[model samples]
Target chain A: MLDLSTIREGDSLPTVVKPPISRSTLALFAGGSGDHNPIHIDIDYAKQAGFDDVFAHGMLSMAYLGQLLTNWAPQQALRSYSVRFRAITHIGDEISCSGRVSEVFQENDEPRVRIELTAANQNGDVKLIGEAVIAVY
Target chain B: MIDRSNIGKSFPPYAVEVENHQLRLFAKAIGETNEVYTDEKAAAAQGYSALPAPPTFGFSLSLSKPNVFEAYEALGIDLSRLLHGEQKFDYIAPIHVGDVITLHEKITDIFEKPEKRLEFIVIQTSLVNQHNEHVGEMTNTLVIKN
Candidate 1:
């Protein structure tokens, strides 16, 4: 069981090996995730649509947060996790993922925590907004 | 004009079986090496049948449910502007390799906000394993720019 008191609101998770977003990495994510949407793999198509280059899938970015949460509270069970895509991520962009504990409450007499998560580039622009609910025994 | 009727209808069930290699590849892509997701022996120690699929694994198979996004063309949806809004999973039991899952989905809710012209729909997809035990559930939202 996870104790919310041990994790402050702004506690940060360990950063993984991340570099400038690339077309190849994006394609790998698409293939592995089975999301073959062209907007994430075709640079020309993305450029024609007003993007500088192919972008990463929003779900790929959000799923990264799952790694973060699982790393922090390995014992807690996930109830739900959701994120809204805010902006497009283009190739060569370095993404930073972060999360903050938002609320702690009880549901059906079980302890739960809500976290607000986000991933952004150095430009101070957000790429995704995520929220998750986890249950801790 | 779109065939509005289909917008709220769900097609027949489709089956999506868990594949160990797929889960392995997905875990590798994210640099994850958790025993629960990588080692069958370790997973069994934790009481799981096999390396349980990760949370978003549903997206890998959830789309297989019949008639997913079939009416988009009729509604003039560019297919290009479509984006995944959010995904939620409710686990009745963990998903493991060799589990043959049959998905039955239904359009549970639909809403259109005037300003956004965005269509919000919820599909509740049930997953039943080879042994016929319910393994997991998936709910997803797909957004299209109108």
Candidate 2:
């Protein structure tokens, strides 16, 4: 849980950097997420679809952002989350998830915080941008 | 082109049981080190009745239908050209292992940008547990290249 007394509007959350997305990770995520889109796992299919190789799933990047949130506060504290896919995450790209407190306020007599999130690759190309609302003590 | 007439069409509700093993696998796949997602004892220590499903784990449950692409297929969407454009989740209650979640999904909107050669389909899903309590809702947007 976040310390409401210390958390400021612009406080940065700890960054979560993931290892380079590998073919094996992609394959495992397919079975785990139940998102077996061929574009994310089959290189031959990707080539047929006009790409050089298979890429990572947009949900996978969102999952990483989810981790970034849960790392700061428990999963149960999350009230809402949303994301927009900005760019494709190609294979072997190392994704770094970062976020900051965008606002702090009270709702329904409970304290809450809104966070702005971003997932980017080693090349500085942002793959996803997101926002999340969490209840605070 | 997607049939705009299909908007507001709701699919048959489907139910999925949250299993501990599935939670463990998903946590591992996402590189999550939180023991509360895998170890029952650790989860209890944290006040969870059982292993708590990780954030975004609901997406996997939503895809558990026998034909994952049934809605898209019925909408005349070419699966090969589809891409996930956006996703939003509103968490109403904490989902845990052993909960049976029934998902009610529907096509909320369908539109296109001819000049941009893009077509968009928006799907909204409401999740309710066996006890009839609303657990969460998901809104997913799929973009198709023309």
Which candidate comes out best when scored by TM-score? 2
Q: Return the TM-score for each candidate structure.
A: 0.84, 0.98
Model 1: CAPRI class: acceptable
Kindly report which residue pairs in candidate 2 clash with one another. Answer: none
Q: What is the DockQ (computed on Cα atoms) for candidate 1?
A: 0.49
How far in Å is the alpha carbon of B119 misplaced in model 1?
Answer: 4.4
How far residue A34's Cα lies from its native spot in candidate 2, in Å, is 0.8
lDDT of 2 by residue, B13-113 (tens): 99999988888778888898777778889889878998998879888998888888866776787777899999999999989999999999999999999
Best by lDDT: 2
Q: Worst 10-residue stretch by lDDT in candidate 1 chain A?
A: A9-18
Cα lDDT tens digits, model 1, A1-137, are 47756755555556533567777778778767777667888878877766676778877776677777776664227877777778877777677778777877888678877878888887868888888777766
Q: Give stretches of model 2 more than 4 Å off.
A: none
| Residues B102-140 of candidate 1: C-alpha lDDT, one tens digit per residue | 877766665565588676555677788778888667777
The DockQ-derived docking category for candidate 2 is high
The window of 10 residues in a row where model 1 chain B has the poorest summed lDDT is B63-72
